[model samples]
Target: MSGALARLLGRAALHAGWIVVVLAAAILGGVCIGETAIPPATVLQTLANRLFGAGYPLDRIDAGIVWNYRLTRAIVAACCGAGLAVAGVILQALLRNALADPYLLGISAGASTGAVLVTVAGVGAGAISLSSGAFAGALAAFLLVALLARASGGGTGARGTGQIVLAGIAGSQLFNALTAFIITRSASAEQARGIMFWLLGNLSGARWDSVLSAVPVALAVTLVCLWHARALDAFTFGADSATALGVPVRRVQALLILCASLATAVMVSIVGSIGFVGLVVPHAARFIVGVRHVRLVPAAALMGAIFLIAADVISRIAVQGQVLPIGVVTALVGAPVFALILLRARPAR
Candidate 1:
């Protein structure tokens, strides 16, 4: 037992270290390859002078390109990727459905709906332009789903899984209708364009302040979820069993739901609706470390960060000079992989 435990820790540490190295290298390489395509040697020279105020001289253009624009965007993508992936992991665990995803509960649709209403209705004004509209939308959808399940008699039983999924599908469609109505009723093409782009997701507008706001919430949620990884494992065994083992199943579920939705909501608000990171990252993590939450969650987060950074790099260069929407590239990559998973996952014996 002692030897086995030691080996597990050693493997976890090794994977975590590799994730860090991959993320760091990707960010550095991406920054150098942005619009100007600065030579790596010049990038190093410019980076040194800009950060430490020392090495070789660099013009303001390169400084703004590296520090102000590209670097900030890459960093934000990494954070968003990790946050969404953790949310996906939590949701999959909570539902005990390999196909369950953060978006399935209607969070994405509701968020997009809220963002659309605000953008269209032009309501409210404040220091913060986005007033948890997306988060409120997400929470509302969550409650709605919970209500749907309860109304359908989905309480603590083996018979409820179908009803739960059915309710989720209904809720998703309802929110989708709401989003479409707002966009369709618009008088001008500009509003339609805005709504369309927002729904599709993009990382072009990543600001330092957005990163500051999102990173803490993301990190906190990830830590909270990690601490509860063991409880999550217990959840896989069913609620009654988990409770019998002294896990506060209800409390843990609520806390995890809030943590995940909050992390995902805030991420959606900032980056719109980048998909696949949350879903694919978790699937990839599952392959890497099986279903152990402690092994799966952190590694999933890292994989997400790396995946999104790499995706963003592709988006940057996909169209030569014009920048493509990062979300488009992610979906293009992610959707097919998801399909493959569904096709290849073995049927229960």
Candidate 2:
């Protein structure tokens, strides 16, 4: 037993170390490869100076841009990616649907509606922050969906799964229509453009405050999911099977779904509704790590962080002078990849 434990610890450490190296490299690239083009060495030196007081005589402007703008944006991007991906994994597992994602519960659409209410409709009279409004909207949407599911005869079986998905669709459409109506009636052209950009995911405004909000939510959600990893694995075979295996089906579902919703709400509130990370990353992680929840969870998070950072970088450099909406870039890539996954999933005729 002692020898087995030692080997397991060693293997775990190796995996952790590898993940750190890869994530660090991705963050560094995100910091260095921008419109201003700071070198990798300068990026490292700036980090050393700010984080450790190494003080390697760097230009003030460059350091400010690296430390303030790019680094913060990269970290927030990572948090968004990880949170969304883990949420996706949880939903796909609990719902037992390959197509399930963070937004499947109408959270993103609700968040967009809430943000529009704050920014375009002036619902708060300038008192509430956009993020706060978005979060509120997400919670409202989820509550409505949950109630709708219950009315539709919620169960822990296939029937329950279908009901939840349908309810989510209805909730999403309602909130989306509300958003459109508000924008059409209340927003001027300029305000509409800005709101639209944010709705499609703009990380340009990411800063230290965004980082502080995002990091904690991401960590908390990930830890909660990991804590319930065994329960999640039991869920893969359906709620009845999980219950038979001594798992509290309804309780686990409620807890993990709430965790997914909270994580999704916080991320959407911070960076707007960036899609496909929650959808595509889990599928990719499943391909790489198989179906085990323990390995699949962290793999999805790591791949998600790298994938979104890369997408963000592409969004910045895709056009000569203009940054494309990160959502557009994600859709452009994710749609085709998902299509291929669907084709592969089809059995031989």
Measured by TM-score, the strongest candidate is 2
Candidate 2, residue 6: lDDT: 100
- lDDT comparing candidate 1 with the true structure: 0.78
Best by lDDT: 2
lDDT by residue (tens digit), candidate 1, 192-230:
886677677777778788778777977898889889999
Candidate 2 per-residue lDDT over residues 1-349, each given as its tens digit = 9999999999989988998899999999999997879999999999899889997999999999999999999999998999999999998998887877867678788888888888788898999987788778877888898799999898766778888889988998899899989998999998888877888989998999999999998889888888898999998998778889999888888888777877887788778888888889999898889999989988998998998999999999989899998989989999999898888779998
Off by over 4 Å in 1: 1-18, 41-47, 127-131, 156-159, 184-188
Each model's TM-score? Answer: 0.88, 0.93
Clashes of 2: 0
Query: In order, how many clashes per candidate?
Result: 0, 0
- TM-score of model 2 (CA atoms): 0.93
